[model samples]
Target: MTDRAKGWLVDLRPDERWDDEACCGDLPAEETRMADRLCDSASAATYIRARSVIRRGLAGLLGEPPAEIRLASEVGGRPVLPDHPDWYVSWSRSKSLLLLAARYGEPVGVDLEVIRPISPAAGVLRTVYPRTAELGAVDQSETFFTAWTLLEAAVKATGRGLARGARDVWLYRPSGESRCALGGIRNAGEVPWSGRTEQFAVPGSSTRVMTAVVTKGFTDPIHVDAWQLPDRPPSPVTAAAPRRLLRKEVSA
Candidate 1:
């Protein structure tokens, strides 16, 4: 399938974030309640900004004003453009970064995470991959987050969410430059979603974010914009194999 994917990385910091009075007005009623239920103030903020961006961005690409777009979530809370069933939309946030992804004619899921050591990693490792021994033998934090993001993107692409796809999906990368493949439930069948992991820097900060996108039948080099700012023009996209998660690369 010829899937066209475009992604934008928006900063969620108070000074650099992209929500305005109009954005607030365009937010659906369910969105406000979802924000009200968020315990973390920061998360509540991210949720508002992310939802607003998704609506606005999708509207831009669809040639309509934000209010005209009817964004809805499927059974697993994965957002979709119900009016245009051919379009797929997804977003993810971590700390102060938000990624908004939209693709035409294919299912898509995107996720972002600020990479660091996980304190409760051991317990989580056993919980997600209980049936596997090889996953436990590798670097727990590294492998876990790698697989974790893949699982998230995969589920989102399939509209399955973690409740249905978590334990079934596993990560495997044969080489540093090789494409990462996701395995199915108990490694039995081919999972519908395929994943790509990218590491990018926040323009002025030292913080690096790990981002992943999964699309149904997507091929090499899906268009990814790691540093698209609200005021600045988008940087050029270079779809290359992902670098190892170490903090050495300076460019996307």
Candidate 2:
């Protein structure tokens, strides 16, 4: 939760058409094949852009060339740097936004979702809503997304993903504040680990995008750096650089 974490938020809206060659030229061969298989141009472009952002961001953090950052996946399909096992990362993409979070040795998970009307379906309510039993009194849409993203972030942090079930994770909001915390993570009806959860709204956007980050264990105040991409390049992150430039701390 402390200022120890770093992240980047990139705009995924296509401002200019990038052909397959332009988009996949610098990607790894596997990624290029995956991109090539996508029939939708926008989806392919978004995939390429997200992978590029991850490479560049990790490269900046590791002080290496983007192409040289080798990435692998954990058991649950979470991406990891095989050489730097201590470095934890998570990625999420909404309609036109991609988010990345990284921290050394600490598990981190981030999720972004564009807010829209929630169907009053029983299945959705059961899967997304916390078991607090007070949901009937609040704004259903806001509460639904708040709970949804928090559970997602927490589950992702655990690396078990939805396989662990969102209902097993609870997000607790201390009345009358924008802040919240991971109440507990229950596996097989037993609490295992606690976490810190923070939510933010992307600035200057017409559509409402709700994002949340869950860091395992308790920590200091969480600082989120929301970067609008293609417009803002990744800040040069070097050990010798000024701390401010390394990770521009922003209040989200």
Candidate 3:
């Protein structure tokens, strides 16, 4: 499936148990070391599985074996290819879903989230964001997820982790456009990102899971090409109706 982007390739898979023997061998020593550092066995396993999926997905694009794809990280931890500097990758997880996105020549960051009702105390982060403030208390989950995804994609694209980015990044609508976008990144480093955030949906579950991405090189009409992956039944993610889209503008 695709949206307005020329194409940001994404794979949405369940963060479930995997064949450790089969996939784990494909991961690098770096990932193994990172996994060893984690105290929670479940969290460590998830990290390993996420990396393995990333390796296979990225290796397909590079026409190499998954085990041969060497990975590195930026100063703030977004994964990258040392040999292929032009390629970029980022991922996010929401409940059972894992979102993996890859882009060539342009830096990209992505986020996925499960929609859930918000409470006042749980929404303290919402108060910092001007966009979420526009949403009513009774009906803000969808819009809140959209706003948060935009904020995260911007920070991830900028190579700054949320610890720092959350304090600085501001979600904004570019004047006349109805869709929310990312702005207010001061330390974007060497890459000058357009900071335009785009949202997509995975239809299933009691509610719905949403994903968004942003390309860091300041491009227009950013687009997404996504796959639901295996292990789940896919359904329609209609963006043509605003009322159905959290009154959010769908960028086709």
Candidate 4:
């Protein structure tokens, strides 16, 4: 079966009043405690928003109540559905933007980074991505962020994260495709990533936002969509109610 992945981008600007009760009331106890430990309201808000997006997105995909979807982190801080091991998910946030990617049948990872000038680009390139440095002089900010997101998405997909060393993964453009159209990652000391990847700009942002997704067994083209929160929150699910089972088939 061909694996399928879906992604959603959420904006975290303070313009909208975040419905804390509806968005975060269903979070697991551990997540609630972690949110409480955030140093400031902004950080807490961002965390809540990210979790809310994940729940809502997953709920829609699984046809279940958002409040009933529970997410837990594995050993390396990778999010997983304890009840559904077949599903894979990954998330990343940059400043006021958050990205969430999920797939069925195969693992997937996503990353987003705001493009900005990197003052000491050489140090970062030399330490984490010496191969990227050899690409020759280019837009320092764009090059660094592009390579950074690619490596992050690859590692996240593999579930090893940066602990495996960013330098260990190499990102390359496949022949006969736009730089953003197709990319691949090869891990030096681990199993290679033989999945599809797509990178694009986020919509409606003044600052350039770059995002990437790495998926296994997904050969189809990827589609990026903007996710808008519902104006009226759905009724919260009660503990007495039974949770719905994830559907075996997912629509493209």
Model 3 C-alpha lDDT versus the unseen true structure: 0.58
Estimate the lDDT of model 4. 0.63
Candidate lDDT (C-alpha), each? 0.63, 0.62, 0.58, 0.63
Candidate 3 residue runs with Cα over 4 Å from true position? 1-20, 30-45, 121-123, 126-139, 167-170, 173-179, 183-204, 217-252
Best by TM-score: 4
Model 1 TM-score relative to the real fold: 0.72
Per-residue lDDT tens digits for candidate 3, residues 68-186, read 67787788888888987877777777754577777776777788776666666226545555435543442455455666777777778768776667656656544554455565566
Local error of candidate 3 at residue 89 (angstroms): 1.4
Q: What TM-score would candidate 2 get against the native?
A: 0.74
* TM-score winner between candidates 3 and 4: 4
User: CA RMSD for every model?
Assistant: 10.2, 8.9, 12.1, 8.3
User: Which 10-residue window of candidate 1 scores lowest in summed lDDT?
Assistant: 240-249
Question: Residue by residue across 82-112, what tens digits does model 2's lDDT show?
Answer: 8888778888988768878887766788888
Q: Considering summed lDDT, which 10 consecutive residues are worst modelled in model 3? A: 238-247
lDDT of 4 by residue, 1-252 (tens): 332657777787645456554555645556656776665666666676677777777776666666677778888888898887888889898988888878887777788887778767657655666665455543455555666677788778777777465655666543442332224454433333443334445555566677877776445334557646523336464322111110111110
Name model 4 segments beyond 4 Å from true: 1-4, 163-165, 173-205, 230-252
Off by over 4 Å in 2: 1-4, 16-26, 121-123, 128-139, 165-167, 176-180, 187-205, 219-222, 230-252
- What are the clash counts of all predictions, listed in order? 0, 0, 5, 0
